[model samples]
Target: MEDMDAGRAGTARRWLDKLRGLIDPERMGDDFLYLLYHDALARRLGTCHDQRDNLYLRRFERPQIELFDLMAGHLPVLTLAGRIGGALLADHLAGRDTATLLSVGIGSGGQEAAVLTALAKRGRAPGRLTVIGVDPAVGSLHQAERAIRDTGVTLDFHHVPRFAERMTDQDWDLVRRAPRPLVMNAAFALHHLRDTASGADERNTFLSKLRDAEPDVVVLCEPDSDHHRVALPERFHNSWRHFHAVFRLIDVLDVSAADRNAMKLFFRREVVDIVGTADDEDRYERHEPAETWLARLREAGFRPMPAPAESVSEPMPPAFVRHDPDSVRIGFDGESILAVIHAVPAHA
Candidate 1:
């Protein structure tokens, strides 16, 4: 048993060294680096030697909604962002007689439900509310519908089961013709749109479309990491650093060890997508820095709104909130992990 443990440790050390080597600037053009990345991820996931020919081909249990609910209850970054975002949305909805909310990538509707609850508490909910949910996953849309219904806020709900980027002309028309004072909530979703290439201009097309919708307020929550434009080596380094912080945060969560491990494991797919997708077209988790997003929003004819007022008197330590001129950033240990931006038509 001792010898087996030593062998496993040695293999892990070798994998770590290989991963480090892949991030070296001098090794940028190495053709074999992609295979190394794949194998390294497979090894780390304990599937490199599995009977399945490919790591991805092997079936792994998907993280359940209960697990995510557990994480949301304990993860400061998530809880804070949700609260801050809900507050901002509720603020925007205040004093509106009729309003429509277009939620891009409205996964499971947890955030929207929270926003509705906040508005109800403030007694500022619109007299007639219309929520348009766009997402590619039918299951998520169903879950979102249920969640929205549970809020007990009478509203018209439209589910557009399509990727935000791939929404049909009719679908967009639905948004354009929705109730007045249209507000959009795109939380951790836009980064999935495929750009022409790393650091390319294709993203601008989508942003321009968003501007055309003429939303009264657009609330965006995105990671403050540069996984989009950089090449694989830099992407690998960035992902490693970013997820290391995330995993460490998870470690201190007051949850069962198994639950904590499951939460960490849920993020493994993101790391793999960041490093393993050799072709830029195939990569979906292309997170850009907050600065990039801000610039893009401006170029798309949206101006940032004032940062949301700090509501929490004492944020948990290690989780700091920074109000920048253009957006609100939530970070752990001084590293900005997520940014919440409120923007509107420059002319608005």
Candidate 2:
């Protein structure tokens, strides 16, 4: 009887933990920012969520600076970006006796370009790198062009006047008509489906085409947060906590009281921010869930290579509530720099 009771108790505890993980009903009343109100008499112990929003990235100018610097401090994403990009280029077009390469969009902060540069710096760059950037956004192409000029990577950018979602069979045919074989990488541009009309089937179909075309490798970054919805008050709590964690890592969140208060107000407003449009709108757009994406690479016949999760911030208590397309995505190391990728097999 004693042994049986102990087993039952253990199972019960596990179930309870799972249940609690799904809900945030601690009966903490209806306050959004604080766990409890004080008459300026008690110690200011904070809820776990406060650190994310109000406390971190509170400064306006340094929002991304706060993120990248902090994430790089804890993880290798920054250091690896350039090296990976370079290696990818070499692997794809190395034997062709050509110095040409292809790329999509400007690439996130030029991570892939930096990687290629590092490779060339070590004497591995193509003699005349031909880079073709395809995006309807001329601005992004210009940024890529500017970087190419500054980096002196022999580049030729084609303003393919269509966004990824907007790219049709004819548009891809145009890309296929390029002189050099396209060995490209998409840093994080695949996630924004043309504009909602995309569900799982649509997403799979599009990725299938990309695989058929067979780029050098398609690298991407997508959200890892378990999608959920939060009430206005819960949004207040989660955003603040994400901010705190980010600022603490950057260690430059010091701001005036007014600025700090303004941030809090900004987050408070986003609680009602219409995240994704209606479900009917889901046909052309689909958000990639992280775990599902890992499976997707393998399903698409790409090999599995796990991106480091150390960039995730210090773990928060399982978030009680979250929103779809949560604007504030915190990383494993505390910054929002989550990414993963797969290179095409040599034979493929």
Candidate 3:
């Protein structure tokens, strides 16, 4: 009886934790109350329901960032961008027998795998490949390592556990010493460098360093929303525009109701974090539009490398399924939600 009671008590505790996680104190009496309230009501009505457990903590918990794609049918824009960028770099460096790749915010290294796979398909897979991955999350680093290893490519990976802003000289030296014609992919990672104040200089400085490094090519994939604005009201409006479109996309997805609800709730946290947090909070989410990235790259002396005309006309797979297309298009689910940029230094 005692052992059985103990097990029951532990289960009850877990249940309590899950319930508590579902209720946000910030939304208890605000305009956002209706949002979570509707979710609660939906659960009670035996309709589609999201997981009650804390999902924000699981953002990068998996080895791959495909959960959002699985639940919401979001096309893998970054991976497609990576493939195109890789092909561009491979063609640019045709004389080189080996190539090195440096990825910022490599999150599970899925994008890098796509880049390598693209190179392989084109008979441009480097004789030897090296990847220098930088991310603040050690868990994410491990996941990236595992994902890269699964590809069975001749790629050497070195992970640096530091945010891009805090990277030391030694960290950069590793990238600089690698073989010439180094290529970089920074997929959905640059927005977090924003702060409460203007990040114009910081953004420029970050890109300037990359410019000085003189990598043959750098690929950047970022959200198309204007969530990086310092003002809360404007940020909320852009986020609303972005997420509302996302919700609509989720609603029509072929996924189950439970999956649909889970995706809604998962994205809700992003809206809350972007709106609720002060500018000084380091953990706040900040996303910027594609034009901002284009200007930044231009300021950093990078010139756009357009996809080949033939590749541009190639057909893309229907939504939800995973496939690499050469064209670097940003829209997803009939909405343009992200930007994929392939560029090289002005003088390179």
Candidate 2 lDDT over residue span 1-348, tens digit each: 122124454554444334334433123212222311110001111112333323432433346445445444432333343333344444654434354344555543265456555656767655556666666677767776677666655555555656665567875665556555566566545655533433345445656666766655555555442222333234334444543333333223344543433333333322222121222232222334555666666677665443333323333422211111211232424344333454453355
Whole-model lDDT for model 2 versus the true structure?
0.44
TM-score for each model: 0.82, 0.54, 0.71
TM-score of 3: 0.71
lDDT of every model, 2 decimals: 0.75, 0.44, 0.62
* Candidate closer to the true structure by TM-score (higher is better), 1 or 3: 1
Ranking by lDDT: 1, 3, 2
Tens digit per residue, CA lDDT, model 3, 1-348? 122124454554445345556666344422233354334323323344445323433432332345555642443343445445555655654435777878898777766665556656666667777878899999988888887666656767898998887778888888888886698878778887854254455677778888878898887777778876546546656776777665665566566655555555666556656654433354446787777787888888998766664433343433221122322555446666666677888875
RMSD of each: 8.0, 12.5, 10.8
Tens-digit lDDT track for model 1 on 1-348?
Answer: 122134465665566546544553123322123333444455544544424223422232345776677768788988888877877888777768889989999988988888887777778767778999999999999999899888777789998998877788888888889998999999999998875535556668878887888889999999989998786667877876777667667766677755665566567567768865545577789999889999999999999886657644458666888888899888787778889998989998
Rank by TM-score (best first): 1, 3, 2
TM-score head-to-head 1 vs 2, winner: 1
